[model samples]
Target chain A: MAETVSAGASGGVLGGRRSRQEAAWGYLLIAPVMLGFAVFFLIALGASFYLSFNKWDMLTSPVFNGLDNYRDVWRDGEFREALVNTLAITIPHIVLRLICAMGLAMALNSNIRFRSFYRMLFFLPVLTMPVAIGTIWKWLYDPAFGPINSFLRRFGLPEPEWLSNPRTAIAAVVIVLLWSGVGYDMVIYLAGLQTIPREYYEAASLDGAGAWQRFRDVTLPLLTPTIFFLSVIGIIYSLQVFDLVYVMTRIDQTNQLPTVVYYIYEEGFRNFRMGYAISVAWVLLLMILVFTFIQFRLQRRWVNYV
Target chain B: MVPKFSTRVNRRSLLGAAGGASALALTGMLPKIGSAQDASAVEPYNGEEVTITYGFWDMAQEAAITAQLEAFKVHFPAITVEPQIVPWGDYWTKLQTSLSGGESFDVFWINSASLPVYASAGALLPIDAVVGDGGVDLANFAVPLVEMYGWEGVQYGIPRDFDTIALFYNKDIFDAAGVAYPDDTWTWETFRTVSEQLTDADAGIWGAGLQTSWQENYYNFIYQNGGQLLSEDLSTSVVDSPEASEAFVYLTGFFADELTPTIAIQQSNPVADTLFPAGNVAMLPGGSFRAGTYGQADANIDVAPLPQGKERATVTHGLANVIWSGGANPGAALELVKWLAGEEAETILGESGATVPAHAGLQQPWLDANPDMNLQVFIDALEYAHKVPDPVVGFEWQIKIQEVVIEGFAGNIPAEEIGAQAAAAANEVL
Candidate 1:
């Protein structure tokens, strides 16, 4: 009887040792990643945060300036203009992108001929490089020789100076912004649409609902999670628009459409005010954070999940 | 149960400690963290083989430059040359970032507008020592071109080429209009009348480009009309003067009368060369560098002295070769910069038919090479040439002034308002 008790105890000990080994393996697997984050990302964040407080021109030794950069950034009119431009361009861009992406995704979700080929065509813009697209679109936005104006002229429409005119410059940039982003968003929405059960649509149809009615009741509610996801992501991304403005507009063409990132670049790189640029970067971070918070707060009201 | 929990914790802690150790080592190894001091050290040139990277952007002149570099290698048999080309629009941004990050090339080209900003930041090595230490003979270069490379008596670069804007006219258009070819005696009024006589709006051809470019247009007019951009002390704006306004009006008057294309038209079709080459424009104020560019084009063009305004002045902009402060080889880099700015490189550049050298002794060779063209207009304009005034202590004020000029050309506001706007912007920087 004592031997039997001893055997049972040993068996228990062996099982415990095996479970402990498995747990240790799991922790070991994740340890490298955690360490990587600590070493690279955490340290970089701390360094930038410290630099944001101090005045450094990258060549001279850093001096502790104690929020002077922030003070100057607050008083800067160019920063304010950039902030306004960022919001002006981003809001319409996000709205149009969401609508266009959802509309295309819905259309693509249906049984259509050459669906794969259509997907490839739609995905072409996503695959194309941003710099190349920016250059090509810059030419297309040319008021005289561009196809945009030529197309408008065919319909007897007055061609507004697309890039050169301050009034229409932001709008023209938005067109390219939407054109570039909608493809990626549509592909994401298409993937989300595929996961949704077809039974929900059938059930809605059995209840005497029309296609639009079904979409409003079933498709939209199910797609809410994806739309919410894209909304938050698109807002975050559009707020940091540097390449679009840099390529579309000349650097010397000031006062019309300087995006927040471009403004930071001009301040930091061109103007050699690194401390001020860091402060501006911090402000951008705060703005993005607030926007992200608002999205998260609003998501509870609309976002649905199975 | 206690033994099991203790074993799991022990294993977790062990794994974590190992990761923590490795992580510390890895972070210590990142380029920015480890390479700052290493960047300052010059690598010894191995006798086996060596390569120096030369960064440039003008793809249009790549063939000529390649030939020049090939010739340079023949002189320095120990070194191999590699050319790195970035497009113009992205060149400054890329070069600036790389230099700041200590990833710069051994040698690259620099421009006057951006030199001060880089020099002030210590991003560039001051060349005064190198030039003073018998590495280069500064006396061979034009004094004005050499002065442009220095800030407050500290030299940072050597002149690569000096260019002054001159009037380039379509010979065909001049013949058709029955107008006398532009000569040294030509005045602003003569330029205006010839433009009006040559203009045919119905044919979609303008007599003059009247380009919105600040370098070619208003800045030249401002100086030639006896107005200055700043006070003699460089402390205040004089652009709001009556003389300045008169100059602005005279330039924009052609646009107002539809004799020259509006800023809107030029902005949309930025083919200053294309229009002139296609015989759509009778005259354009372009530089000697562009003379070579148009020579290769379909245009049967001839050069003439710029139309004399009140003062016979023209804007002179030049290119330079600046060595970065922390390049892998300051010695070799300095030698390369000096050679490129010296008679050797200038003669090769002239023979290659690229641009006129800023080296005084090298001018005749370039003029002789382009004997078919009126190359003397460039050399004569150098007498009236002026560099864009240096900016305020930290910022590049030229960019700000150009911004205002572009605003005027875009017709964002009235032409008269542009001067005041420009003055305010300049004061903001000052």
Candidate 2:
């Protein structure tokens, strides 16, 4: 009986040693990945935080100047204009994208012929580079030679300036943004549509519902979760829209399309006020946080999941 | 007995080693040792390979500039010139970052718009000592162009090329309208009349294309109207003066009168040069540096001096070859800069038929290179030309003007208000 107990204790010790060896192997495999993130990304975040507090003009040594940068930003009239412009653009852009993307996704989900071709056509804008898209669309919206004006002229219509006119410039940019962005949301919604059981639609139809009624009762409710997900992502992206606006608008104009991020660029690079630019960046971060939080709170009521 | 023997062995080995080392050190100190043998093993390099890179934003004339660089290499076989060519729109942003980072190129082109800001920041290496030591005289280049490179009586760079605007008219349009060709003596009234006659609505062509472009359009007219962007002290707005307002009102009147295309039309087909070439515009106010481009165009083009107003003035600007600070081998970089700015480099650029070299001696060759058209208008405009004003930060004024003018041309506000708007914005920037 004593010999048996000794054998069992030795076997337990051996098993414990094997488990410890396996745990060591797991940690060794993941060590490189963990080290890479700590070294590159986390280090960058720490450096960015420090840089945001100091003033550095590339060639000279950086100077620490407390929150003077924040004060200067608060006083800048252009910064105020940029903030308003950015909100004006982002709010409308998010609304339009959500409506159009959901509408197109629902329509395309129906038993439609040449469905994939239609999807590919809408997705083409997403694939094209922003610069190339801006160039091509700039020509199309040209008040003189563009087809848009030509079509207007044929109908005895007065051609409004699409671009180059300050009043209409922001609207034109929004149109381009929606045209380029809606397809991405549509693809996401399409994936969400596939997950909804077909029997839900059949049951609604059996209740003698029309198309719009069916959609109002079934499609939109089920698509709310996707709608919520896309809204969060879209709002975040539109708040930081730089390339499209930068490429579409002429560089010399100030009020035309001065998105908040572009304002930061103009101050930091063109004016060489790095400290002030960082202050503006931090303000934008706060604005984004507030906006994201609001969307999250709103999502609880409407974004339903099975 | 064995353990005691092992311990004894260890003690003997340690003491024996220490005593041998001490004896060798004492012996080495007693006699002369040849350190020369060690020094020969690690010799400093006498002939080292060095590379100097340059960044520029003249993509439009890159081919000709490349040819000029190749000729520069013939004189100095030791240095290789590497060029980083970026587009003009993106150039200043990258240049500002590179300069501030102290990782800038050895040589690059500097513009008046951003030069003072860089100078104040000490991003440029003062080339005075290098220019004097290298014995490259500046008198051979155009005096005004050379002066653009200096600030506070210190030379910072060598002017590479100079440009001024001249009237580029489509000969076909003049012939079709039965109007006489514009000459040096032409006034603004005469220019307006010719433009009015040349415009044919049925044919989808305008008489003249007046760019809403700040410098190319209103600024040129402002100088002609006896107005300046700023006072001599660079502290206040001269833009809101009666003369500057009159200049802007006069130019935009063409749009109001339908003599020139609307801002919408011009923006749709943005390139002013393309419009004149394609017969959509009868005449264009374009820079003389575009002589090669006009010469190569399919249409027959003629060049004339800019029309006069209260004063005869055309915008003249010079591109300078500047050496950046904080280079590892500044000595070698200075040699390359001096050579490139010399007569040989200028001659090569002139002979390539690309640009009018900054050197005064190379002017005739540059004119002769283009045999088809009379290229002498550029030289003639030099008499009436004034350099574009140099501000502390150049792009600030440009951005302000563009913003103000867009509202003016859009008819949102009176063109008369443009001066006041521009003045207020520019003063803020200043």
State the C-alpha lDDT per candidate. Answer: 0.75, 0.75
Runs in model 1 deviating more than 4 A are A1-40, A192-196, A251-255, B1-52, B60-68, B79-82, B129-135, B255-269, B392-395
lDDT of 1 by residue, B1-430 (tens): 2323334347567556555654454344322311222212444344434666778887766876787777777777776767889987678777766764557776888787667666766667666655755567788777778877887677878887888888888887778768888898989999999888988876766777877667777788888888888788777777878888778768767776767766555654554655677777778887788877777667678898888878898888888887767666666666567678767777877776678877777778777766668988888888888766765364355567667766676666688877777777877776
Candidate 1 positional error at A266, Å = 1.8
Residue B259 local lDDT, model 1: 75
For model 2, residues A1-306, the per-residue Cα lDDT tens digits are: 233333433668775566445545655776698457644554444444555666755445456788777777789888897888787888899999999988898789888999999988888898888888887887888887889889999999988787766557778888898999999999999999888898998998999989899888888898888998898899898988877667666634444668889888877877777666877888888888999999999888888887
lDDT of 1 by residue, A1-306 (tens): 233333444668775566556556656776798668756665555556666887865544456799899998889888998888888899999999999999999888889999888877887887888778888987887765689888999999999877777658889889998888898999999988998898988888999999889989988889998999999999999999888777776533453578899888877766767677888899899989999998999888889978
Clashing pairs in 2: A58-B100, A59-B100
How close to the true structure is residue B368 of candidate 2, measured as C-alpha lDDT? 81
